[model samples]
Target chain A: MYICLMYSKEIVKGTLKPIVLKLLKEHGRMYGYEITQNVKALTEGKIQITEGALYPLLHKLQAEGVLQTESEKMGKRVRKYYKLSQSGEAVADDLISEMLDFMQTLKSVLNPDYGQA
Target chain B: MYICLMYSKEIVKGTLKPIVLKLLKEHGRMYGYEITQNVKALTEGKIQITEGALYPLLHKLQAEGVLQTESEKMGKRVRKYYKLSQSGEAVADDLISEMLDFMQTLKSVLNPDYGQA
Candidate 1:
């Protein structure tokens, strides 16, 4: 059976980080679950960030000093909220710019009529 | 000193296969150097495909039956050409659609104002 997906896993994999960063840029300080829900709702379930993928990337971004986190007591568990650090804000801006430019380039490559090439 | 690049290596890395596939779809069979030059010209030198990256991807796609290659003797050396296989055409079409959709999703993520979100 051929199952149609709105987007491919490969495309999703490459863009996950930027998606997270941009969401945080738009809506400041989001908890992990909030991030997931926000993305799900925003993309209409076309783009779901698995916990396996999201947490590690969050951790890595934190480790790289690009992200900051704070925890609040939520009943028996601590709920962590994440936000971009100042450096992360800069990184996000740079990445967003790069991503947009890359999209234009890819569009040109796919549809040469769209470009001067 | 921060040197601005037209696109990041990471973005280029992820899109390379689709770029190659799309070019072949537009221009028919192409050899390795020709592919590189076509990308260079098309992207206006913004997206250069390094041999180290391009060859491995070509070989991998060939192995996966997504691409077919034909080699011709060029005097002292043999020149190899690549095109989408019959199945590869379908794959390329699917990927191009997915990539375009993913680009829209990514644009929405980056610029929520543009989306219904």
Candidate 2:
């Protein structure tokens, strides 16, 4: 119960782009379904992200100039792939660092007694 | 140069609320502007989140029923305090666990060689 009311997928959805963009920035490019599959494989099913959440974040990231998308013919449906823009690459690095710091700060606040210096 | 394009504040802005909500879920009621100041203080300016980004996120969180708000008189202006709803509390816990797992998966893929067992 203590942990039950602590986080939201909507918030996760909002932030997933930096995670995806950062990965793509290093790997060059990746596809929609592929991105979802990769995340699932990496987390081993503990952190399953639905297509509904991912696609919208991808679209929004692409629209925000932080991500670039290209299309490829894949059987019947066209597969859309995404990569980071020059600006996006810069942003991803900053994001990872900031998030790391943010996590620490949260840990300290949430466990202040033991978290003390 | 390589790190220049790894993160985007806009993307960060979108996800700030889940973190904020998680904090609020633990802290109970907190103010609008106070939220921004606290995040800044916590991150040591490395994660200086602006009021523009925070207020919108807070408003949206409130709208989504992940947050509840009440107004209080403060000098010349009224300050709004936000807390988690029954549903919002449940969401925060899930978000934190999911995000933690995500961070680990991301670390592995980004650093594949050392990441392997």
Candidate 3:
């Protein structure tokens, strides 16, 4: 039985950071599972951030100074919560603003009814 | 010139590639000047992507197989045109869909009026 998987690797490579940064930017802080669940809920099961992809992104974010981690004991497992760093907050604002602008530009180009490109 | 700039480096570092990818994802293909001009037009002068940064990203995207380039001679400049590669198209779809989902998740967390985080 071939279980056709949906999320492709190339997509993950390109978008992992922005998605993760955007998450930390808004939520203040969240554990690994929480991030995954948030993505699942928002995407309505159409999109998911796998552990393999999510953890590495968290680590990279920490390395880049865009994220920080705190430990919280949740029952048995001590979960590491990811949050935005001081620099991360500034980044979030810039990213969100730029993206919104990009969306408008894209709408103009991709869906010409929005605006003439 | 104590020209206080709006686009901070941290913001640029965090958002550079996604913004570029998002741009290429929407517009079929465009050159360096066009990309800068496109960003300017959409941003209404609020955001500007410099050539130093833009070229490196275009080169990196090409390296990553998410973009392919063709040369177009316009007046004195032989501009390189970037389009989604075979994988880039799949990557773009996945990136766009995933980002929209992430945006919803972020709205719930940041805005709260959208949904519960």
Candidate 4:
């Protein structure tokens, strides 16, 4: 559960939920370990989600009905895979769109030449 | 201090500090009201910073030695303009760079195709 990167932890924390939702949207369904590995691979080891951080959020999302899980037997331990629920699909699209729009606004704030008066 | 937009309050809250720092970096120095007006105009009113949120952060940054303030009199009222201090300039650059990098990473997370395997 180590985050070895140039970015600060707080900033990464804010986007975790959205990142997970986006990954699930693209991948269909993913187990906890698969999620961690994919994030590492996707960011090229720049951003690593710790089990300490990931599991609680996954459980919380499941509790909130935003995520639905299915369990399968692997060896002896059960592997829980997560995907978005019906309502969660709508929530994910809305959140992703809002995040994209917010990013555009942030770009405008950073580069005032495009920001107009 | 109304944030009447599609974006959630929590999402906007996370970026306020960086947004303020980027503005001070771009505009040189700005007063509280001016900062709010610029953000409103820049985002085309999609994002607005409330006095309640802005003042506390300004004070906190000032206390942390990341910002220095100048007071100018406008008739009966004194307006305080904030700019980065000597050390603050460094901090501002660092924060701005980190924010931009984080945005790129967020984009990668949102779009898996560009994220590479």
Q: Which model scores highest in lDDT?
A: 1
Q: Model 3, residue B28: what's the lDDT? A: 84
Candidate 1 has an lDDT of: 0.84
Q: Tens-digit lDDT track for model 3 on B42-84? A: 6555467888988987888899999999997879978789988
Model 4 chain A: which ten-residue window has the lowest total lDDT? A1-10
Q: State every prediction's TM-score relative to the real structure.
A: 0.90, 0.57, 0.51, 0.87
Residue ranges of candidate 2 with Cα displaced over 4 Å: A1-40, A45-117, B1-13, B113-117
- Residue A36 in candidate 3 has what lDDT? 89
The sequence of per-residue lDDT tens digits that candidate 2 reaches over residues B15-111 is 4655686569767989877777776666455456677778878888788998898998889988889998999888776665555544445455555
Calculate each model's fnat, 2 decimals.
0.64, 0.16, 0.00, 0.50
**Worst-scoring 10-residue span by lDDT in model 4 chain B:** B1-10
Which run of 10 residues does model 1 chain B get worst, by summed lDDT?
A: B1-10
Ranking by DockQ: 1, 4, 2, 3
Docking verdict class for candidate 2: incorrect
Query: What's the DockQ of model 3?
Result: 0.10
Ordered from best to worst lDDT, the candidate numbers read: 1, 4, 2, 3
- The alpha-carbon deviation from the true structure for residue A38 of candidate 2, after best TM-score superposition, in angstroms, is 5.1
Pairs of residues clashing in candidate 3: none
